[model samples]
Target chain A: MTTLSNTQELPNGPVAAALLAGGAGAAMLGLATTLAEASAGVKNLLVWFNPVGPLSGKTGVAVITFFASWIVMHLIFRGKNVNFARATAVALTLLFIGLMGTFPPFFELFVKE
Target chain B: MSISPREGWTVLHGMLFGAAFLLAFAGGFAGLYSLRPEWVTAEGIKERILRLKVGLWAMALIAWATVISGTYIVYPWYRASDATSARSILLADPATAAWHTFGMEWKEHVGWLAPIAATVVAFAVTYYGPALAKKVGERRALMIFFVAAFATASIAGMFGAFINKVAPIR
Candidate 1:
C-alpha cells in the first residue's frame, strides 16, 4: 500500500474500483470523440443545408488544429492524463463553436441552396 | 427547409446533453460514495440530489416561460390561421426576409420540441437515477425520484402540446 513501483500508487478495494471506472469513462469519452472525428462526413452534412460554403471557413482552421492535437496526444501519446484531457478539450471547444456558426446563415435561408 | 414546429432534433440534443451530464454525475456520485464514502464530509448527497432537482425545475421554468413566451409573440408565422405577421414577413427585403422566414421556422420547431425534450430528459433521469441509486444502496429514494421524473415529464409533454395549440407561439 505504501510503496509504489510506478508514479500512481496501488489503491485498496473500492478506491481502486472507483479510479478504474473513472479512467474507463474518460477513455470511452475520448474514444467517442475520436469516432465522431473520424467520420469526416458530419462537417459536410452541416454545411449541406447551410448557405455557408464550408464547415470550418476561417473558424474551421481552428478546428483542424484542435483535431490534429487531439489525435496526436490520444492515439499516439496514448492517454497520458493531462494530454488526453487537454486534447479532447481543444477538439470539443473548436467543434462546438464551429457548429454554432451554422445557424446564422441557415436560419436566414427559408429553404436550401 | 420547412422547419417543423417540432424541431425534435435540437430539443432532443439539448435534453440528451443534460441527461448525459446527469448520468455521469450520478455515476460518479454513486461510485465514489460506494467506494470512498469518506470523501463526502459535509451534508453530502442531499445537496447533490437537490442540485439535480433544481436543474430540472430551472429548465422547465425557462422552457415554458421564455421559449413558449417568445413563441407566442411570434405565433402568426407558424399558424397559417395567424396570417398577419406572416404577410408582414413576406413584405420584407430579400436577406432580411429570408432570416425572418427561416428563423421563424426554426423557432416553430424548437418551440414544440423543448417540452417534449424536457419530458424525455426527465424520464432518463428517473431511470438512470434509480439505477445509480440502487447501485449505491439508496433504492427507495431512487425509485421515488424516478417515478416523479417520469410523471412530471409526461405532464409537461401533454401541457406543451396543449399550450402550443391554445396560445400558438409563432
Candidate 2:
C-alpha cells in the first residue's frame, strides 16, 4: 500500500493547468452566451439540439473546451512548476466574465434587436 | 400521489443532484479550510484527504448531473413553444415574464460554470493530496474555485425553485 506523506513535493503546474482551463472553460461559456444573444446566426448555430435550442451548443462547447483545455494544459504543465498566483488571477477574471455574461441584465445588453 | 416523468426528472435534477451538491459544499469547504499541519496530525490529514477526495468528486459529479439534466431534459419542457409551456406561460404575463427571460436564462447559462469549477477543485485536491495543506497559495486558489462552484450552483438552484413555483414544468 502506498503511504501518503505530508512532506512530499509536488509540482504546481498541473494545478495551474486545471485553474487556467477552468477559467478558459468559464470564459468560453460567457462568450458563447453573449454571442448567442448578439447574433441570430450565432444563436441558430448554437442550436445543436433543437429541443434545447442554443443552450445545447453553448453548454456542449463549454464542456468540450473544459476537458480539451484541461488535457492540453495538463500535458504541458505536468511535472513542472509555474506561477500559481498569475494563473489564479486569470482564472478569477474569467470566472467574473462568466457570471456577468450569464446575468440577464448584462447579456441582454448585447441583444441584436 | 405520484408525479409525471418530467416532474420526477426535475426533482432528481434539483432536489437530489443540486441539493446534494449544495449540502456537500459545506463539508468539502470545512475540510479544505482546516487542512493544516497545526490543525491536524499526519494521520488526521490522511483521513481528511480521503474524505475530501470523495466528497469533492461527488460534488463535481452532482454538479455536472444537475446541469446536464437541467439543460437537456427539464429545460426542453420548460422552454417548449406552446402557450401552456413554462416559458410561454411566464412570457404571456408581463408581470411574470422576468421569470423566464431573466431567471431561467441566467440559471441555465451560469449553471454550467459550477461543474467546470468543481471539477477543477476536485482535480487539484486529488492531484496534490496531503501536500495541499502546505501549499498555501494553491490551497487558496482551490478554495476560490470551490466557492465559485458553490455560488454558481446556488444561483441556479434558487432560480430553479422559484421558476418552478411561478411556472411549473408540469
Candidate 3:
C-alpha cells in the first residue's frame, strides 16, 4: 500500500484542472437533463419529432439536451481563457434554464403542455 | 406470466437506480483521487486521470438515465397503473396520502437538488478552480468540488431508492 504524506501538497498542473472540468461537465449533463424534462414545453417541442414515441420521448429530449448543451458549452469555452465572470455566466445560464423550466408562467404562456 | 407495463417500469426504475449507484461509486473514487493526486503513488497521476475520466462520464450518463427513467416511471407508468392517484388519496385519506405524496411530490423535486448542486460545482471547478488556485490554493478548491460531487451522487442514489420503495407501481 502506498502511504500518503498528509503534508504533501497538491501538485500544480493542467491535468487536475482538465479532469475537474471533464467531471464537472458530466455531472452538469445529468442535471441539465432533469431540468429539460421538468419543462414540459421542452418535452412537447422535442417529442414533436416522435423519435421513440411518447414513452421514451422525455428521456430522448433529456439525453439530447445534455449532449447538445455540453457541446455548446465546450465550444464556447474551448481554447479560451476562462475567468470568474465567464464561469459565473455559464453557471447562471444553466441556473436560468433550470429555473425557467420550473416556472409555470413560462410553460403556460409558451409551452403547449 | 407476462409483465404488466407498471411492473416493467418498476424493474427498469430499480435497474437504473442500481446502475447509478454503481457508477457513482467508481466515479466518486476517481473524482476524489483526482483532487489529491498525491494519493496515487502507484501510477502516473496524469495517466490515471485520463483513464478514469470515463468513470465520471459514465456516472453522468447513468445518473441522467436514472432521473429520466424514474420520472417516466413515476408520472406516466404510475398514472396508468390501477392504483389511486396521490391527489385522490390525499382527499380521501390524509394519513395514507402523506406516505405516497412524500415520494411522488416531495422526493421528486428533492431528487433534482443533486443535479442542480452538481451543475453549479462543475462550472466552478472547471472554470474557477484554476483561477482561484492562485489565491486560496488549488487543493482546497478541488476538494470542495470533489466532495460536493460525491455528496450529490449519494443524495441522488438515496432519493432513487427511497422513491422506488415509497412509490412502487402496484
**Top candidate by TM-score:** 2
lDDT of 1 by residue, B58-152 (tens): 55444444333333332323333334444353434564454334443333332332332333233233333322222333222223333322333
Residues B1-170, model 3: lDDT tens digits: 68777667656655655355455664555544454443445334434444444554555455556566666544554444334643344335765565443434333433443443344334434443322223234434444444544554554456445645655555
Docking class of 2: medium
In angstroms, the error of model 1 at A109 is: 13
* Candidate 2 ranges with C-alpha deviation above 4 Å: A1-6
- By lDDT, who's the top model here? 2
- lDDT per residue for candidate 1 within A1-113, as digits (tens), equals 21112223211222212222222322332232232334445335333223222221222332233334334433533322233233334323432332232234432332222
Clashes of each: 8, 0, 0
List the candidate 1 regions with Cα displacement exceeding 4 Å: A1-113, B1-43, B77-87, B126-170
Q: RMSDs, each prediction?
A: 14.2, 1.8, 7.9
Model 2 lDDT per residue over B10-35, tens place: 99999999999999998999999999
> What does DockQ give for each predicted structure?
0.02, 0.64, 0.08
TM-score of 3: 0.52
**Each prediction's TM-score versus the true structure:** 0.31, 0.97, 0.52
List the pairs of residues colliding in candidate 2: none
lDDT of each: 0.34, 0.91, 0.45
